[model samples]
Target: MLIGTVGNEPYQRVSSDNGPYEGAMLGAAIGAGGAGAGIFGARMHYKGIDNRAKRHISAIESREPVIQRKINKVNEQAENPRMSFIQKAKSKIADSGINQINNLRTAQLDSLNSKNEQLRNVVDSMQHTNPNVANEADLSRRSHYAQSYADINSHYDDVIQGSRFSKMKQQVDQSMEHKQARIEKNRDVKVSRLNKELEKLSDGRHKWGEDGVKLMKQKHPYAHVKGIGRSAAAIGAGALIGGGAGMILGGLTDEVNKHVKQ
Candidate 1:
């Protein structure tokens, strides 16, 4: 009984003494483990952040030259005049065609006026002759003059109202309309291209800006991660490891106490 008591007393003392020591050791181990895990997680998070930054930087750099070129092109077009050489030539041609029509009309009118003048002179010369003969000559001359004038006027009107002239005018007007349309189309195309280039520049920057946080959330790992820092994951992993270690230590401590009591 004395031997049994001695052994039991030492066992109790050992259990008691070991309890706090084991607790402290387990706590320290858990803390160390957690700290290590947290640091590792923080490093991983930092790596991811750096990688994302590089991706954005690379994309921005790659597109900068293209954007500059587009900007230069747009500026060049803006600095230049609206009318092209072809457009000027078309305008000149149209003016020349109009002038030609006018000249043609003037020439026909002049020819008719000269004929009328000659008839008038003949009628005036006949007035000095015998009265009866002068009267007859004057009447005939006047009739012929009137008839010639009427014929010339009729011919001029017919020529003016001809389908050929109408067709030519129509063709010129249609050509002008087509040319105008082409010029407008070209202008619109240039404007549209410029707008697209501007849009690309704006959108690319937007993807790399603070607004890109929302876009990042849509990605894989970024979506799973709640915070932006590398330390968050590390801290979470450390907490889990520490908690498990603490639980294991508590269980071992409980078993030791039970054994001592028994």
Candidate 2:
């Protein structure tokens, strides 16, 4: 009877504890596994995000040189050259009183030349119609007109010769100056935009990197701690139950020996 009780007692002890022990171990394993996985995944994800941020920062930095190259190209294209002699003279002679008088005289001379034939025909008709007035008037009018035309033509020739190259050079130089100014203005705006974009990328990269570091600090160690705590608790409880079972088995063995001895 003692041997049978001992055998049945050991069976009942195992049957009673088996489910709870297995349950505790399973729960601990799942908890620890989940925590470990969470820690690992979080770390990996943080690394991925960090790498992407770094790449973004690098890409932004790379564009700085490209922008600089564009600026350099524009500067090269728009470089100022020294003024030519004609350009200098044009700058000196512009809008002066002498130049205005010369322009007006040249215009009058051109108009007089256009109407010369008609004026000569009217003078000849008048000489036929009124001989006395024509005889006196014709000599003075022709003499005065010819002398004035000659003097004005000579002055216009001088003015044109002095100003022709100057005018053309001034036009060409002004065009270059205007184009350079436009390019410089556009370059300034482009550089400003690039700088803003680069700053934005830098700021974004820094923020993301800092956040990743903080998240790693928060998640990785915490996950490990949780996993270790749960696992340790399960292991300790299993040990305690096993020790109690050993004590019970020892007592049952002693009783069985006593019954055999009797």
Candidate 3:
């Protein structure tokens, strides 16, 4: 029977029960198995296992608020950038992809603005001075600094707002990078489930392969599914003839033992 699926695809598993209860029991069993696998022989092993996984999951859920707070801080930092003359820069890059990167760019713009303003102030001072040589070398250097700053800022703007698709392409690439690990993990889970199913099918085939020797060995193994199969056969036989207390006793004993074991 098909067990179920996880992730994006539907996967099937082999089992005797095809009913909904099978799934319910399987869920409990997996929970129990995960728990009991750790301690090995603990009582109510399955129950403990089921509970253990739940507890672990609960613990993780409890950390969600703490994680959200940290993410909020990062978001705020990205949203706000501080710099002298950066007010205009921030306004210019308002709708850019990432707030943090935009803030850094705004800061650079602020730096350029400050340099140009300082250069202009210097030039004004020189014109006011008596002798024109207030410092010709310093004035030339300041002029070069302002020109270069303007050029850099213009080039950066060109790269950022050049094309509509550029921002979308960057967003897609970043999304893929973030989801890559989860995709791989989901793939692994699918493959592992398939492998387990294949192994079980192979074991069943080998156990019942023809020539009848392996089949005989399994049928009469040291411990076998003694009650149900035997009783089923006997009942089928008895309905034809009319009576069989021995078959019923064997079946009842088998059922009692199975219940006690469970």
Most TM-score-accurate candidate:
2
- Model 1 agreement with the true structure over 1-262: per-residue lDDT tens digits: 3234334422334334565445444554556566666565655764575467568767877777776676566556555534556555665665565566657666876886787678667767777775677677768767876776677667655665563544555565576677566655666677677678667766766775666645654563534444545446555566556555444454455565577689
Best by lDDT: 2
lDDT against the true structure, each candidate: 0.59, 0.62, 0.47
lDDT of 3 by residue, 69-151 (tens): 65455445434423324433444444454454556668887887787678767766776664366567467767787687777
In model 1, where do residues sit more than 4 Å from their true spots? Answer: 1-103, 109-161, 168-197, 206-262
Total residue pair clashes for candidate 1? 1
Worst 10 residues of 2 by lDDT: 15-24
The residue-level lDDT of candidate 1 at 224 comes to: 48
Give all TM-scores, in the order shown: 0.30, 0.35, 0.23
lDDT tens digits, residue span 80-192, model 2: 54455765666556535346757788689888776776667777899768988876677767887898799887876577557754465457568668767886787678767
Clashes of each: 1, 0, 4
Per-prediction RMSD in angstroms? 14.6, 17.1, 23.8
Candidate 3 vs. truth: CA RMSD? 23.8
Q: Return the TM-score for candidate 2, rounded to 2 decimals.
A: 0.35
Backbone clash pairs for candidate 3 read 3-13, 31-50, 32-46, 35-49
